[model samples]
Target: MALPSAVKVFLLTMNRSLGHVRQVEARPLPPRNELQQSVLVKTFEELFAELRQKAAERPEGSGTVAALDKGVHFIGKKVVEEAAESWMAAEHEGRERTAEEISQLLYQAQCLMIASGLDLEDVYRHL
Candidate 1:
């Protein structure tokens, strides 16, 4: 099945942030029976790479670009907002909702990292 428009946009934004010149196309999910055998997952390393590229390119109309343009303070506020939402979702929402909120939180946090000129290695060292 084709991805929903929202998902497509999200993927497109992600690809653009990664400095991909080509358009992103939605791919069908693996069959349910094969899910346990193989699943596609994007790692945090990939996300950091994308954020680094976004910091450099600053593409117009991209959320990552907007966040980066706003600088670290604004991005830090968003990170806090997403974190609060994630906590609330975990406390009061369903698993999927909680996951979604957490994903948002992570994205914002990554944006903050980019704004601050930090990378995965820096974070890993701190951790």
Candidate 2:
């Protein structure tokens, strides 16, 4: 399946950040509308690499698209809310509950990034 250009650039850029590749600047981002097929991902890190490409590439007027159209502040609020919930879950909940809460937090984080024209590589670079 084709990863949206945003995701690919994020991954390539992140790889460079880990010194697994050359500098991020040398690996240019593709145009926003570009699309390219990705290799089958087989690990959690690979799978964890980015937002689900399908979700990122969902059609206009789809529920995700509609929510995203609400703007970054809206998504940012959800990200904030989810982050708090994740923290609560980690402190007060069991493993499964924590996992569930983190999944939600992660999704909202992705929404925030997407809405802001950011991506997973942005998160990694901050580390």
TM-score of each: 0.67, 0.53
lDDT values for all models: 0.78, 0.64
lDDT of 1 by residue, 64-124 (tens): 9987888888988998999989878876897799978988888898888877877788899
Q: Which one wins on lDDT?
A: 1
Name the 10 consecutive residues with the lowest summed lDDT in model 1.
9-18
Clashing pairs in 1: none
In candidate 2, position 48 carries an lDDT of 39
Q: Would you give me the overall lDDT of model 1?
A: 0.78
**lDDT: worst 10-residue window of model 2:** 35-44
